[model samples]
Target chain A: MSKLTIVANIKAKADKVDLVKAELLKLIEVTRAETGCISYDLHQDNANPAHFMFYENWQSRELWQIHMNNQHLADYVAATEGAVVEFTLNEMTIID
Target chain B: MSKLTIVANIKAKADKVDLVKAELLKLIEVTRAETGCISYDLHQDNANPAHFMFYENWQSRELWQIHMNNQHLADYVAATEGAVVEFTLNEMTIID
Candidate 1:
């Protein structure tokens, strides 16, 4: 199985930045402890406070899929439903 | 100085995937050797061949700015001018 890299960008609604960010930060600890997780780091844009990104590396795509379908992720979706305005996810492979 | 994380997404014109990728790859060696570089990893989308991203970490934003203004980056811009269709850069700080 090949390693997978995920770049997920999340943009919060103008009035919901804190709400959205809190929910995102909550995912880090649990996700980092999951099986096959290599690294799960979160960042907030320096110039755009409402923009956040997760730069993650997983042992394999299959394990990443498992992580995606976990209950905590569902909880996140429910918690930030309307607070998130734009979300884009890219599943990538390292060039090397 | 605070550390900086950069998420740069680049999309190539459908027919120019190889060209754009080659040019992007050309920056790795020199950029990695730069003074403040911590990591300069590149990735290509698994589902979209034309989508490429660079996930970089630097010792500080000031050092990153220096890297941005260096000749290799300028050369990359010139080399992939018409071949790239979209580009977005996010300068960020790790949440901790």
Candidate 2:
């Protein structure tokens, strides 16, 4: 399977930062358990408390696609309906 | 030193892909040798041949600032000239 490295950039609403963070953290455990998930790490911007990102590794695009449509992901999106202001997904491949 | 994770998203001009790749790769060795560099991983997009990104871990924002002024980085920027289209820098912190 070809590897896929991703940087998911997220910005939580100013007033809902903590709630959004709690909801985002739940995705980590559930995402790591999915097939082809090699690494799923979450990060926040030190200077910007409301900004967040996820550095992820997947065995293949196929597996990642499935995980994207997983129920947990849907639940997360639903839970954070107005909690996020900006959400961007960046899919990458190692240069080595 | 406080940790700082960064995702540098880059896009190379269509004609300068190989040259840009070469220049970008040179940063790996040099950046890793810097005082606070813990990890400096380069990656490209699977679907976008011209797109690239760097996943970096620095010991502190101060060290990273010094790195920004490093000669190698300056040289790379100069060497590439107009080879880049869009460059976005994202600073992050581990959520753990």
Candidate 3:
């Protein structure tokens, strides 16, 4: 298993950013607590109010998969259903 | 002059990334050569072929403005006219 980088691009609904933000921060904390997590960061694009990006580094793909299936994630997905407009998930293997 | 961090999120046309990429790399090199530039890096989102990000650091906002007005950047913008779908520019003052 190699190190994995996940870049999740999310766009939350207008005026619901606070609710979305709360859920995302909690999820980020939980993700960081996961055994395989190396680092997890949440960034909101300054110019785009609805745009958000999560930068995550995991020890292995297996551990990352475990993270995806975690109980908390289900709640997060359900809570932010319509609030999220675009969600793009990318898996990266860093070269430099 | 305070440090300036610029995050430029760009979306290029499908299958036209090669042309856009060439322009971007050239602009990046020119920006890096500027006296105020500290670092300039270009990254393409692995899962989103159209998505690109330029992480740039400059000594000041004035220098960044100069970079923006440079002839190379004008050419880059013109060359990538229809090829670009979205371009979000963010000015950040680092806290940490």
Candidate 4:
């Protein structure tokens, strides 16, 4: 199976930056321990405090999908509801 | 000097996907040889062939800025002119 690369960009409401950031940080530890997880790194934009991105790699798309449906991710979604102003997700594969 | 992570997204004009992708691919080898480059990986969207992204890590923003001004990058810009439809760049820091 081919590796999966996920680039998920999230922007928080101006006033809810910290709340959204905290919720995003909460996902890191648990998600990193999941099966097939290769790398799960979170980044915050230097110019836009409200912008956050997750640059993740998984062994395969199947494993990534399982990770996506995990309870913790659901909790993250529920916790950050309405606080996220924009969200975009891309499932990609390395060109090489 | 803190490390920098760059997420650059490029979208090709509908009819110019191949041209833009080839131009982008021409960048990898030269860029990876530059100073302070840690990783310079490229990805293509699984659902959107016209979308390409470069996920890069650098030792410092200063080094990355130097890379940004290099001749090879200028060449890439020249080569891909009018072939690219959309581009977005984010300079980010890991939330460790």
Candidate 5:
């Protein structure tokens, strides 16, 4: 049980990008229904209306740290404070 | 000329990971060299052993179409056949 990949590079506020893309599509469908989620995808940057990407997969890393302490992604990160100017997170494996 | 984003998910055989990785390093460099390319990042799932992604952005679609025709990438595709188990590509736009 060691499958976990989470790559997120979110930057918003190019005129609020349609209210942060409708709150990131309900936060990627509630993080793909948690519980060792296998996939959760979200993307943007058709010219960078404030670049964004959140492609995730899990089955380990302690269930992705309990899906980042659930609670609706901590209330959608406190309702997207400041609309997230910039963020980055990357953890990957599988060298082939 | 608007912005464009390209995300590619490439998979490789669980065993042949090393060899292809080296070849890919060069491929990515060349693609990134394209005149309009803004970003091109590659990633793989930690547990899947046969899952990957390629995140890319360009200034416009015309240049990206040309990039697809680049000879080097054509060659890499030929070099790794069975090793790739699954692949996917996504196109996105900022909706906010």
Candidate 6:
């Protein structure tokens, strides 16, 4: 299990749903192009559209850390600063 | 945006790590051949090897529910009953 995976659950403010969604979707394309990126996806709760989750796989924890500090991610975070109401992050590794 | 995704976090009892892992990996091959399964991946925690997470994608929620009631899944559940210590599940839709 060498992959560094990330599962991040996030909630957006009611009024900022569209804005938050656009930014999250942008992460998929941008992050996937970054070095060491294996997989990057975004999911939303069907019952609660404002609730979202990020599913990502990186080559290593160190690379993931670099992704966390990347300018694109930082920009997304900055763009959605207060729009996100709540978030929970989980860092994991592949079990296969 | 139509995909039904599953994020299940599970923890195996300290002594049952190997047993739980075998069963979890078995799911990948078995589930992938099922009707609507798109992607099925298994992951563990770097700090806690016993901790596992399932990242799955299905064509539809109905198909995913059918998978939940499938015999293979039922058997896996039965096989690892006591080995799993804690679990949390989240059902979501792809945010495209």
Q: List the RMSD of every prediction in angstroms.
A: 1.1, 1.7, 4.3, 0.9, 9.4, 2.4
Model 1 stretches with alpha carbons more than 4 Å out = none
For candidate 4, write residues B67-91 as lDDT tens digits: 9999999999999999999999989
- TM for every model, in the order presented, reads 0.96, 0.90, 0.63, 0.97, 0.59, 0.85
Per-residue CA lDDT of model 3 for A1-96, tens digit only, reads: 778777677889888888888888778667888999997767776567677777677999899999999999999999888888889887765432
Error of 3 at A63 (Å): 4.6
| The best candidate in terms of lDDT | 4
Writing each residue's lDDT as its tens digit, candidate 3 over B1-96 gives 787777678888897888887788777667779989997867777677567777677899999899888898899989888999889887764322
**What is the CAPRI rating of model 2's predicted complex?**
medium
Q: What is the lDDT of residue B59 in candidate 3?
A: 96
Better of 2 and 3 by TM-score: 2
Rate residue B81 of model 2 by lDDT: 95
Can you write out model 2's per-residue Cα lDDT over B1-96, one digit (the tens) per residue?
A: 779888888899999989999999998998899999999999988778899899998999999999999999999999999999999897888885
For the second chain, the TM-scores of the candidates in order are 0.97, 0.96, 0.94, 0.97, 0.85, 0.93
Cα RMSD for predicted model 1: 1.1
| Predicted complex 6: DockQ | 0.62
* lDDT of each residue in A1-96, candidate 4, tens digit only: 989999999999999999999999999999999999999999999999999999999999999999999999999999998999999999999995
Q: Is candidate 4 or 5 superior in lDDT? A: 4
DockQ, every prediction: 0.80, 0.67, 0.23, 0.81, 0.21, 0.62
Candidate 5 chain B, run of 10 with poorest lDDT: B87-96
Maximum-TM-score candidate: 4
lDDT of 5 at A8: 72
Q: Name the lDDT value of residue B53 in candidate 4.
A: 95
Which ranking of candidates, highest DockQ first? 4, 1, 2, 6, 3, 5
Q: Could you give the interface RMSD of each candidate, to one decimal?
A: 1.0, 1.5, 4.4, 1.0, 6.1, 1.7
Alpha-carbon runs more than 4 Å astray in model 4: none
DockQ, candidate 2, comes to 0.67
Q: Mind listing the fnat for each candidate?
A: 0.76, 0.71, 0.18, 0.76, 0.36, 0.69
